[model samples]
Target: MSLNKAVMLLKIIFILTAATSIQGKVYHPSYIDEASTFASSSEYDYIVIGGGTAGCPLAATLSQKYKVLLLERGGSPYGNPNVTQMQNFHISLMDTSPDSPSQPFVSTDGVINARARVLGGGTCINAGFYSRASPSFVKSVGWQEDFVNDSYRWIERQIVHCPNLAPWQAAVRDGLLMAGVSPFNGYTYDHVYGTKVGGTIFDKSGYRSTAADLLSAANHTNLRVLLRATVLKIRFDQSGSRPKAVGVLFKDENGNHHLASLNVGEGKSQVIISAGAIGSPQLLMLSGIGPKSHLKAKKVPVVLHNKFVGKGMADNPLNSIFIPTKKQVKQSLIQIVGITKYGSYIEASSGFSQSSKSISYHHGIMSAEAGQLATIPPKERSFEAISSYIEKKVKKKIPIEAFRGGFILSKIAGPNSKGHLKLIDTNIDNNPEVTFNYFSDPFDLHRCVKGIETIAKMVHTSHLLNLTNDDDYSMKMLLNISVDANINFIPKHFNDTSSLEQFCKDTVITIWHYHGGCQVGKVVDSDYKLLGVDGAMVVDGSTFLKSPGTNPQATVLMMGRYVGVKILRERLGSEAGV
Candidate 1:
């Protein structure tokens, strides 16, 4: 070979090697757990305290210009089929293992819901429904519209899928409109009132695309992702009137403590808390940056006394009704939603019945519903999970039908109701005292009652209800059916409106969309910086000021994309890397 030809081949080899090395920067939690590998004293330009729905994308975007460390308290979602498959959506929630993606926790109000613990956070286990923030919601949160639009496009290209609705989902779309949700808006990424089909995170093949996919956009040379690295606390500098978050102390898989600090630099060096609704405020208060008196009660030394950290915690409480049909309805999650003239919102899914496994963990009103569904008085109604095997072996041969067929849920999108988190123990591993205080305000209960009535009316008008038999049918009869729970006041029918109020109390479930701990207006400034802390910021669902009036995953992703670009824009001229 000629010397010049050999030299050219060597140059190509060197270029390829360099590119591969750059993309291999992310590490497992144990890599940093070792004292020698990652000394207790380490630093970075940005330390993101959660590898969740928001944290992953935000870190990816930020890494384009500067160094970023993303620490997650759970395992990676890459190989976990329970998390990666849309079919295992319910199974993931029912998983009882310590490292299960969905960590079940009971709120003080007796609400039974799980917290997301996998690297992609809630997106790993949530129903995979996707819808953009309402224009009003975007405006209320004080976002720049053009940036919001671009950000949505950027993130959507990575994870959002325009789904082809199943037979059941299509029926739901028509039912929503028939129920007075009004003028069908057709397929849209835009969120608004009235019946409309929206985008989803689940693709046509039933494979889920999560925020973890967005990590592909990261400048791998500058980004480091560590899993099972639980952040214990955010350490702060208290020399000034307000505290400044300088570093985070985290525990690795081995329970060894490590600290990540801001590198010696300018204003951009900071710690960010995107630990989610329950976790963000919990960590802030653990770091001594919450309501002064509440911190004092928890025996945590007050660092900043920002009263709003854990205040105004709100969840879109789901009022659920399980409809039994003679024909099997295809299994699915939220695909189409109904927006009422009132503030309430309605959505439906098929094959999404609360599991017998989860029923074992029931508390409060959930226990009542679980009890009613349990202790089967002979197996009358039944539904088999549909799969290719079932289709080929059973369904194609015998025509087996599904019994536990329909799922209907109503939510008060803009709830007047609110709750707060209380510290149960100073130990960071212990779950905080979560209280929904649902129905504490009667007006809130009134809205829910009205929503229930509207759903009942909608069910009657829905073509979906045609599957019911003449013997046991009608929305009133469905409401009257209950698990053999010995609760008093068995409703004979819905004729007496009085029974409806009691019914609402009996079957409420969380759609699991928890928002507001470090809220936008009250806890963080318009820029998403902590109100009383410097060198820190929060970018997650907790930052939402109002409910999206629909499933909130899309809005949360939009926030992640929006905040990431905003940080870059803020340091446009000043930062060295940018």
Candidate 2:
């Protein structure tokens, strides 16, 4: 470890020691392995499902004053090199194991999306670029701005850190400005439009402190975390007039069944589902709390007929430009972002060229369009939409010894299209059917096309001229996209918007920012309480009304903190509107 990380670790230890009575041990232990260390049959003040990005902090905060049980479907990240190392960020996604941190799946729409199955969730595997939620997002969701800001503070101090920008990332910063994304705002985590160096989860030593680290401030005496514990369903007690969530039934790593129940009371006991947008909605439907007709079709008993359980699904789609350099450049993930006004954001990452074997074909969350025509109607499909399909696809890995250059990614910051998640079968082992009608809205397609043109312009900027041009900016490197586009073609000019649409159709994929399958104001209230259910709540990205204008990690963290406090406040009769 570097001196910077050593000091930070030591400082954390110091705080834990100094405040031991106030806070308990925050360590990742396999509750299933050590049965004596955990309870077999017990009651918790709260049962928190899915120890992920949202679940970790939410359970940690709740454990301060109440007994909380947090269950994770995958193993711990404590000893996983692929999860704790910054450069190995992509390695976990390449994992095909059933319990991989990122569980890969193909959507009904033929989009390749992965759901987080491990502790700390996507923060354990995603590009570490971090930023605050847009102020508009906080307002639209009716979140207390002060509480949200404070919640971010609790996370930033633990896992969030400033990145040491390398030469390639610096070039990306300058290039974005040269492309007219002006007024560099220096290094800050505030959400704003224009060029800015945001926060990162990777420390200066390249070690990542995941959201699990936030548990250090949790009351371990009141908290219990079970890894390899798959929650099959939310057990409901409909003995009263309204159905109440009483507990959850989960299986341990040994395939032994266990039931975790809430303390006996009317509204005294609670269940909070933080299993993410996909898992949360799927679990709801399986528990018979979704649409009546859909649940009945799947042979699930009707509990409450919530018509909008799995209706709106939004994913931020991106188009990438891979420019291979002759010389080796510095390596890093996301460091700088160019937030523009054209309903798009241009962010760049370095450091991938060093890891040659990891960039697999699965990187394309949405494959080429020809294979996708099956998802749509035959009348809606056309021959022109099939360019660069399976035939023109690039190789899984680049063979060049020193393949180093820039990777400029253009993402539609705000998308108009929405999809849904439905049950394929009644078995909990079976995955839910996900359909992302990505470009279903022509306006969304138009926005992504505009983003593509913006990225092309950024590539040709004077700041990045050194990439394609030699000294004196005359001769240039080969614009050979034979592998990427499958044709020997050079850009006629930087502002070429004609092939822009084709490029997006061919290479665009999801950035893996999925939200709104169980949206707020539609399915749940602003406070995140299930509309027709009592004693159950959701505090994950599934509650997002729309995708925020930036990466959703910080926003998700804020929601966890906000809802955690809200639950605690209501329990105490303070009723603070956080």
Candidate 3:
């Protein structure tokens, strides 16, 4: 190894060792408290709306000099096994309980997808893949390169790890190279073209470290985090020249209401909304800051009518093929990826353990999407309604065992097929109606086809077939003719161009990489502040025009720290009269 590479390896080892040393201990920060403990009203220099991936790090960084308050709608992830363990990954998404960490929503396009509801957001339930956004992406967004690099390092030091590739992942990596993906870039965190082993949030022992761990760096005396505190509205002071967001109305877990306001200080206090893509736009509309016609129709008093508030929504279209091996494959999540020039990404996961009960529940949830109960007008769901929905939708019991198979997934890169999000109900807890309009652009459809072809070539490579315990003939037969409950085989002999295009349309699913809605240069200014409002900003995936990297978790985490540092610099400059 070169001098720089050796030093880098040593640094990673030190950090990982320090992280492993604390695996067995529970260390809840002193700033954390239940929402019920809050008074009727409180004030802070910075009020962060969502305590998810971006919110935690933003709040932690701001607390270094100013008082900060972070409000989360769900319970903590500290004690949740489904969120903390890698093996139970699918269970969290399949869970349909009232307080489940993953909240399922069906789009108008007839796709069933889930979003994060817990304090740590998607990081708590994701496949834990981690990679930084490309330098070109940072430059496009006009962020300082040095600051972005520092922020990425800040996040990596806490939760990121170089994964020890399992046998299946190793074979896939070799196959990617053999199939002309080109230039093997060994292990890396950089988002470069070609096959490479990327960082994972799951450690060697399969324990997931989330963005919430960033809160350990917070100044407890300056920060206060309230769990189960759902913000209902952003209260504006119309007396000002521009309607200024001065406070927010929120409800506690016990159904009691409370208000959190910005403090009257010289530091330019503000309310920052770090809610996910769906939640941020929904909250903004609920606060009367959407299109005039839509708000009036919903009986919501209009505050600021920006036609683009909920426009420009987009979700990367994902297509996958299931490979069911005859022998047991070591279970793993996404630890390796193949970045292609054809505008698609290839990744694989093996041996995901899914319980029979959860599989049944998953089936019922998707089935319910086609029924009237899924589109019920009520914002609050009752237990009886849920029970009725399940009973009616689940006609037969599914006999799914712990799955021993793996999947080869291809995700479209920066999909040009844009969508929109709109309110279905007024309640903050309710899911909004969204339509991704997958493959609406011909370019996106072509990319999907190219991606599928790449995966087909990789599957046929000798590297993959040779490493498998099953004989080559059987594996080829399985590839040629096998259909699972979830995925259908898109055979290597699928030569017709029209057939491949239709297959792309018929089997498209979400990789949970959806972003946009309150996009930059539209609803928000370059600084992420809402265009027509003051004292408020939206700083999450909702503001992105394109998804960053192979996985967005790392960039999203870096964004929180990046924005915090900028705000601090501005405040310091103001204090010095620069």
Candidate 4:
């Protein structure tokens, strides 16, 4: 048979196989139900809100022995091509519809960002890089080291996959080594200081397996997952000396309200908010657990005055160099990462195709200016403003071909610069205003400068230089060494410290590794229990003081399982009168 016919036959077989597999995997989880079908009220041993990265695994682990109800504001990711297909990464973010899994929001700091609005949370929409928390990070968080390791292994076994490095990725890996980032760690899920190929949630077939897939480990009979259930407020019993979270008031997709309550007689029954960094803190504030003055200003009845609910928000600042090569690079997402001692991470992705709509709306460095104008929905923009903005940006439109190349990006590790989240209103659907205050701290700024300098060194390295044609303008653009470099692009020289610093500030973008709104010790205890309330806790990225490892997803997934086991052990001991 001809090669073309053979390839076509393979594609057909793969699609058929994938269709059958998906039917068994996502469609019939059996425990999931739409919130529209939910009764007016129900009781459970545990009520977990937000079925994203952390929530799904937490709920699944809890359901192993206790009755658990998991509430997610978004729909299942089952048939979403933009989410499941690795090639359609940017397509998911381009969708600005109300029901889009990737929810776009601009920070007050003027950086564009996105938050997960789907069942699997950020995992459903992210680049899928997976790495465990550094040992030091684990120790600082006060988790038992052995338990943390075990939890990571549990998650790795379930959802993580070792990615085969594409040509561009392999070249980037060698480039990182040549740049003096040293001690090549080969392929590892462990967070080590060096260049390494990390695990990904996308498998060999380029299909994603999200935290929602972790539900396969759950006791389905004991778990009830409700989709399109936006929890409006935490229902607290104030009759006691201290407020206790008893239930939650939530609305379904159809706007009908329902209450899911914790079992009254079960003293250990609790409500866990795993609603991510932004959502968790916002939920807490809306539920009247934030700053007393802020809650009052929003007309929310205060249950407790924590003073700190939406503070310490931090997002690692990312600066990238887009390298358009003479030779077509294979399409890839994050596979190789350079973990440096200079408090920076170097990562790369190559060859992504974005729709024109996405390019217009993308908040990345390429069209960030246009993105600012596009932030407002089309209906909200005046026709004149829309036309004028489009004329300027779209008229000089970047050809889709320019995007066929890859990005070599750098993000500062555990950025010391922090900001806060504030309520614009009490509605959970509306995103709370957040400011990351990127590079406000001199330490963070210094780290960024060093990181960018490192990138310059990498591009000049033999590995990357060998890949670039000598006459190629893209290589010269790396450091703007050649007069032939693209004149439209602003190039930063390695030795020019001022230029690098300015470049860092001017082109700053979010890697979407933001964390710490409802921070540890401030809003919740080490055990993740809410400081001011009984039978309540926040168990998500919001509790993190820093982003763990190279990416937070793997650690977040591990956290769910870790915390669930902890809670289960405590409950079991309590039942046995220990």
lDDT-better candidate, 1 vs 2: 2
The alpha-carbon root-mean-square deviation between model 3 and the true structure, to one decimal in Å, is 9.1
Off by over 4 Å in 2: 1-40, 353-402, 471-479, 483-498, 573-578
Tell me the tens digit of each residue's lDDT in model 4 across 1-578.
33234334434543553565455545636788999988755689999999999999899889888999999999899876668888767656645568788787778766767899989999999999998889999999999999888888888898889997898898889988988888899899888988999999999988899999998899899999999999999999999899999999999999998888899796989999999999999999999898999999999999999888999999988877766566657768899999999899999988644333343223132333322223333224332343354446443455433444567888999999999999999778998999898889999989988887787777767676666665445654433321232222334466888877766776677788999988888999999999978999999999998999999999999999999988888878655211
| Candidate 2, residue 92: how far the Cα is off, in Å | 0.6
lDDT of each: 0.69, 0.71, 0.78, 0.80
Winning model by lDDT: 4
| Residue 559 displacement (Å), model 4 | 0.2
Q: Which consecutive 10 residues in model 1 have the weakest lDDT in total?
A: 377-386
| Model 1 misplaced stretches (Cα beyond 4 Å) | 1-42, 352-403, 469-495, 573-578
> What local lDDT does model 1 show for residue 465?
65
Return model 2's CA RMSD, one decimal: 8.2
Across residues 160-216, which tens digit of lDDT does each residue of candidate 1 receive? 888778776776677777767878888888876678887888889878888878888
Candidate 2 lDDT over 1-578, as tens digits, reads: 33234334433543443354335433445332322234656789989888888898898888878888988887767766567776556556656556668887666655556788878887888887789978887887777889788899978888888889887778889988877787899999887878999999899988878777776678888888877788888989898888889889888777777888998654677788999888999999998889899999999999899989998887887766655555656767788888887778888765452333323222221122322212233223333222223223433222352145656778887578888989999876667888777777887778877776776666666666676455422113324344333422223343556555555554446678888878887778877787787878888989886776579888787677767887788776554333
Give me the candidate number with maximum TM-score: 4
Worst 10 residues of 4 by lDDT: 481-490
Provide the RMSD of all predictions against the true structure, rounded to 1 decimal: 11.7, 8.2, 9.1, 6.4
Kindly list the per-residue Cα lDDT of model 3 for residues 1-578, writing each as its tens digit: 23234334433543453466447644456778889888755689999999988998999899988889999998788866778887667656656566888888867766667889888888998999999999999999989999899999999999999898998898789878988887889899998999999999999999999878888888889999998999999999888668888889999999999989899666388999999999999999999999999999998899998999888888988877655555556778899899998989999887644334434233222322222223232222333443444345322321222134566778898999999999988988889999888899999999988887887777768766664555464345444343322223454345666777777776676788899989999988888988888899999999999999998999999999999989988878655211
Ranking by TM-score: 4, 3, 2, 1
